[model samples]
Target: MKSEAQTPQPNDLQPEKDEHKDSYNNIETPATDAENSNIIDITALENQMRNLSIGFNLKWLDVNVLPRKVVFEIQHDVQQKILKPLEDVVNTMQTVGLLSMEAQTIFKKMFAMFDGTETEYKFIECLKSADLYVVPREFVISNELRPGVIHNEQGMDNDPITGILMPIKFQLRKYLESPLVFDTILDNLTPSQDGYIRSLVDGTIWQQRRAKIDCNIVIPLNFFFDDFTTKDTVSPHASRTSILGIYYYIPCLPGYILAKLANILVAGYMLSEDRKEYENEDLFSNLVHTLIDLEVNGLTISYNGTDVTVHFMLGFITGDNLGVAGILDLVESARANFYCRMCKRNREQREKDATEYEQTFRTIDGYENDLLLNDVSNTGVHKNSVFNQIPSYHVVLNVYFDLMHDLWEGVCMYGLSHCLNYFIKVKKMFSLNELNCRKNVFVFGSTNSSNIPNDIKDTNIIKSKIKMTASEIKTLITFFPLIIGMLIPEDDPVWSYFCNLLKLCHILMLREIHPKLLDTLKSLVETHHTQYQQLFNDTLKPKHHNIIHYASFILRSGTPRHQWAMRGEGKHRDAKQYSRVNNNNTNLCKSLSIKAGYKFAQNVYNSSFVTPQIDLSNSKILDYPSDITFNSFVAEKIRLLNNSVHFIDSFIKQGSTFSHGTIFYVTYCNIINIFELDCILKDKSNNLILVCSSIMCRRFDEHLQSYEVYKTQVPKLISNIGCYETHTINIHSVNDKLYFRFCNFNVTDKVIESLFVN
Candidate 1:
């Protein structure tokens, strides 16, 4: 509740005293003030130079580029020219030690051609081209036992055999004994340089140019294979074996160069200052002491092959190197002085706050009645006040020092210990409890939550909330955000965690809205899977008409009842039940039946709606067949009305609301249905045609009197029988097509004649 800024601490007086002393010293030397000032300026410059030297030294400890280049060049030359040629010579000599002059001459020529070229490729070519090529087995007869010798026979011969010589083995030994042979060969093929000339060139142009050197440092070949075998022997009976190649890169050069440069720079800087008499030599001395201290207290040194490399480059640069022993003394002294200063400051700050609080307390009328402060007589209770409490400043300072010590120890040990020590130190300085408190304050202040004191809260609530926290709010403010992130549409853990924190914070803070409101919203969205269903319906509604039309076409194209019996029956049941319950036998009943049928049919097509089946057996029932009517006049009227209902339902369900184009299309489609009735009449038998014509004429008179006919075509057949046979009418296709059948009817002569005469 208290402001962190109001909490004060003591200040050191030594800095002030030192300033006064310096002023006094200046006044005492009034005759040479300018000279004295110059001395101080020079001292400051020297101190800065010392610091820069230390920084560079630390950076150099990690890597060195200068020496690395030399090492790399040496390695590159050895691998490309020396190692490959030596390997080939060793392999060749093993098979043919003593050769005829002609063969030896040819061999030497081929070796010269391939020596520094693509050695592997040219060697393979030479072997294939050679007239007297031999594998290792053909050359050796006596298998003398030696450290690296290989034998396949049961016994060993102590003396050299007649035609046998180990070419690869002999050549390898020759090269090892005399490495100068390959070096000389490479020198003849490439450029030559003496040590003095190279040094001269390096001194003249090295610093002026940046060289980009690239090379694939080879891994040692010896490590890859244990032994090898030879085939195609001259005797066709002997065998041979030999060890494969041997190599590893030297990584010390780069680091070495870097350390050398650092030493040069640091030494140069120190010498430069020593040449001039700079004042405050103690500061530079302290810097030198710090470097020594870091080397001892911070740096970790290790050897790689022949070169020495130091870890913790920063530590080296920052170290006070008065010497290892002196560095420790400096650290101890600094730590003690820092701690004493902090402790004194905290005590002074506490006393100042206590005085202010006492002054403020006197202004309050019922200060004695208020229980804000403890009685001075009670030591235990009084100890709880800020005046008696140990300051957090000292605690934090101690933590920082401990952290530095741990970091030093970690660098010496290396690996996870170093990493863990760093993390622990960081956590100690920025405690999680304090972090949480700050987070809570930010959240409350931002949301304008009533739980936060108004006086402490900001007036521009919206803007304040926007700027309140840089970090995202926790998963505790609102339940809807959580539930929506979780179950309603899809699951997302990150979103859910965030929302949950927001909601939880909201509840804990007790804002204007109750927790129940969020719960209810979640419940509504979740209940009956309503949110999911609504989302699905809204997405699918526009496509519903097209789906229905496709389904109807598929059914009319001759799908058997058995294929869709369960689905059709379910749709019929839904239509009938919904009609019976909601319509109450009014005109709405007719409308409901049509709407329900349209909706049900749509669901059946979707394959998502529930299907009707026998509960116990899960068997489907077939849709009822339509019955034929003798009264053609009544049937025509019913057909016209059904067509209208179908058109309206389809139009309303598929068409976009408030669109004139949709309205026009619906009207046009309905008109087309009316014209279809006339086409049907023309195709019927004479007797039925007469009946259809009369019905159409009467309907036309009632509905189409005001409109002029664009084209009129009267059908040529008309006939009727007073008594007709009952027939079955199959509603094969609900939309676009229908089929019917007449059965058990006698065709009277008078009716047949009337149909022909008409």
Candidate 2:
């Protein structure tokens, strides 16, 4: 309700003064007395000139005048060029009803020409040109005059009414400084006030009327005299009658111009008030607290009925800007309060009307008559109207809802909703997936009998299928990871990856896929591969020799020609021909071939073998059992071998035993190492390295059990090794190749630490 002029005072004026004072104090002073003496005393003169400038300008006529001054300057050029034309059009509109299409078009063109441009000088020019007076007066009036009735000898008509009236001409000479004195004298002589006095003395109504008419005649004569001097161009005596005739009747302009000027001033004042309100201490403090709450707690304010309610929600603030939701909520709350108040007032009025009707009719028999009368009084013969039955709460709530929607619509113009919806969907998906996984795990055991078997055959088949399904799910979840990675700040690489995985889980949950199950399988595969690759590269004589060999195998397996070349025999010829025939038969066959390639890669890339220590630990036969325990033997052998010997088999064979032995000795050592046996039988004089083939055959079945467990469990063990944990080597063979590939390099250690420690 406070005017806008009141608002800007504290905000603009005080700050400006303080800034001026600060600038003055901060100004560099002359160092020498001579320099100080030479400095001009301009401060007082500047202040004087500034005050004079403010006084002359109509925009600076009031305390709240910043925007007026700005607008006045900006429209000066347009005003200079178009003010007369616009004024003419306005005057014409007053005389005529509505403008014709052509006249309207011309007016629109003029408005567009002035309004669309941004010239400060033109704005000042416009303000200067608009300073025209339709009628000359003896005194200058303030431009800040409000719309109201003014008394004149002619009559007490409304200020805005337009009609012919005697023209009042006045010279600017005598009354320039004391315009109010002249105005006071004329006001006292006007018919509306002084006519009654004249009537009381004259005793006759006719005499009083003539006196009033005489007083009206004097009003024009006063201005004419002011415009004239003792001697003029034509003599006062010669033009007395003509001047009297001219002064009798002229035109009266509407007072609405003054009213419009007042309205413009009011609007400017309101704007200033708003500015000051923004700078007020109490309001600013409240705003600061509100903003802080919005930032820290995700706090949002809304109105429920007449009361304001605040809401807090957790999660990162999204969209283009922060605190958008909080702002929207505040607006909604205010609107709800407004609607509630309005509804309450309406309900009160309705209840009052109902109570009055009930009080008027006391008896039951008179109720019908009273109801008819009440209906007729209130709604003109309405009988049980639908409006009467409409619930107040329903109407209030509807209005509240509408206002909230509008408020949110404005806030969401920046596209916050799309981002929020996407994030929410992902979060929900993650939650649902986790819930379902827990439920499933509770309902079923770790392994199913129908799918899993007691032997290695069934276990291998089931594990492979599970791994394939998990890989597919992982690939699907990567979409979310990619999006999350894009959203996270580039400076936070660790958190970026963390959020990427979290979002991936969220996306899978939304899709109704069990993320926990997929995540577990992914972890397992990653652990196995990471550990195997590390040990394989670390122990190999040539660091990546094994990996290169694996790549070469893949390249050969991909094409029939390469496969036949690698086979080194004619046995592959028929098989190669058949593969080509199958490829041409169907698109399904080609798809299957691609899938087979991927499966083969997965198997070869993720192969897990037991560490040499575990293999030796399970060995039952040893020549020097006391000296050749599992840990000591494997550890010593690993220490003796080069780090790269596991992958570079030729290097290992060349470095030791093979160089000193014949084909028989080489074959015997290879068999013993491949099969992972300790020499239990002695030949001649502690020749334990050479064992009887029959003894070896006898223990072969027992060795197979240990070998199977070593192959399976060693991979699991190596895959589970910590980064800092020590490992021992085991000799294992695949496809007639003796290799020490497995070493304990656990991947689970880091993953567990990250997930469970904090």
Candidate 3:
């Protein structure tokens, strides 16, 4: 922990004449003629100040403190009054059209409310608080601000890219010491749920202790790096303001906690373009050295009144293809002969669908040899990466591909667009107008309502790009079969290709992929690729080639879903949001860091965990069910009525939400069974009991791409499976026949292996 130096706090109730005069100079007033300006208007100025003071309506404004402690208390109260509004002022500068200097002037006026006892400098001092203070540093010789909004007029070196390096060691220590985070990590050493063991710590390598853990406690860390545009792409300044954001998170935390922005820590940021490779390496050297030092001499932190040495290693690095290329210092061009960082395969071979040649993968020795070669075109290696400096990590093996970009945006988009074009344009199975109409009127399930894809435009279909976000593409592909399957024949080659692609996506996204499933996954990829090539007579893109390595990556790491850049990319939104609000282009990185520091400090001060809000006081309590073994089910049984069933509209556990009609799966009699949440119940100990109505799967509906299921004769009083992971299903009644379309097709296999399934 970093020790904070105690500075003397300002006494806001008392004003010094010199300080008040300085603050008065900061307020801007309209210039007037000498005669009007020279006239004495003290009474009017005093009345205007009094009117402005009325906004706070401070009752203590008239209090006369007789004791030192009372004066200190009043000063503290005044500081608290300014903090909230000051934060608002800082965050809303762009909305109100004020520059940094102008905002500083307004802050001066705000401080004047404390009887001008302090100046703007003192207020800034207070804002710095012991938590963190961000100051922008120049990375180029020109001493320009950030690259985009400013130009070097003095003809200095034009290589301008400002950078901000945060305190990583401090953040790591804080995370280790935080009870909310540390306790969760400890509790989740194994899978928190039955079949959802996707965290890095749960991987075979980590479980076998293949990696070194020489301290009393080990923290698994995952680092993410990516480039994002701060400005809209249509703007001329967009590329200039492009930023390379660095972020990190603990993989040991539950998936829900890891998804939260509060848990993701920002390491640093710098302008991405107009910078040399070595400069990027230099930016990461600080982080690299810090990790090495911590690994060598572990950080001892106080946890639960005991001190333990905490050590951490880089679990993996995740990013889009371009970002991964940059991190590994490989040739970034996807069109290059050796474009892939993981393996060496040229475009010609992939186009030919060649598999006879022995595969050559990138290795540490190969990387070094490639670095020595003068002409490195044949080899993808560009230069040495600073990430390889870690003790047991190598950029070649530890760096993983992001499934979001590779699958969702790349493969899914291409495959779906081509299939859609073939169906609507070539085969003429259905008109584009009809498909669009169906999509717009389709009723999505509750889980997928938020991620519905946008209307497919003519240009999107014509170009075979399927312009949509990663999430939108995933949703569209999952339900695409349902929307148009009735019109297409089951044996249609194009439809088969699309279905194979959809199945591949579902298997890749499984949280706990069985070892046997890897072979299935590999076969699915090959089958999908061959089917696409045969149907369209087109070559597979680089993403299709990249996915050939996913199953192997999953074995080395955990599931690809957990290691994807979806959440890490989300961290970029914070900077983007702050950019929109502050609009401090000159010191963009500095302002964002300061704002993030305040938010992080607030998180640290408050409880970082969100308690589940469940109140059933107004509902009636029912007796325990007669068939269910309540005593055997619960560890400690309590009396009924007090220890009874309390029905709730919904139940929230971890990050999953359960409600009536929500379908989930469990294991019974060594077979996979399905059930719907009938109602929620709570025992005297507040443990939830999930009363579900059983459903039986009849057959797989090929047209709907879902299990044809019907409700059982009676609702079963099942216990021990409440609040399990859920799967989405869109219940439909067409021509008096009911059908259920699963949001994901692989839910059955996952449920079978889950230990929680009973």
Among the numbered candidates, top lDDT falls to: 3
User: Clashing residue pairs in candidate 3, if any?
Assistant: none
Rank the candidate models, highest TM-score first. Answer: 3, 2, 1
Give the Cα-based TM-score of candidate 2 against the true structure: 0.13
Ranking by lDDT: 3, 2, 1
Model 3, range 1-758, lDDT digits (tens) per residue? Answer: 54343443464333554522445446545333343334535455544553344322222221222222333355567666865567566657846655354444445445455453243234334434433233323343234433343364444344454577677777766656665667777776654354434677656656545345555566777888888777777765665467778888887675667767778888777767634544446677767887888777778778889887777777777788888787767788888888877777777876555231325777768877878884557888777777878886777666377899999998888888888899989989999899988887777677688999878888888888778888888878887766778889988888877777777887887766666777778888889878878888889888888788777777667787877889998888877765655555665666666555545544554446333333343445544445443333232322333335455566555555666677766533224567776666665676666656667666777655666677764444544543344443555554455566553344443333343213
**Candidate 1 lDDT tens digits, 516-603:** 3334323321231222223223221111111112111111111111111112112223323333333222132223322322232222
Residue 49 of model 2: what lDDT?
Answer: 40
- lDDT tens digits, residue span 640-675, model 2: 532322211111111112111111111110122222
Each prediction's Cα RMSD? 47.0, 45.8, 15.7
Model 1 alpha-carbon miss at residue 374, Å: 50
Give the count of colliding residue pairs in each prediction: 49, 37, 0
lDDT of 1: 0.23
List candidate 3 segments past 4 Å from native.
1-161, 189-197, 202-210, 232-240, 274-278, 354-359, 609-645, 666-672, 718-724, 727-736, 743-758
Highest-TM-score candidate = 3
TM-score of each: 0.11, 0.13, 0.75
Report lDDT (Cα) of residue 529, candidate 2.
30
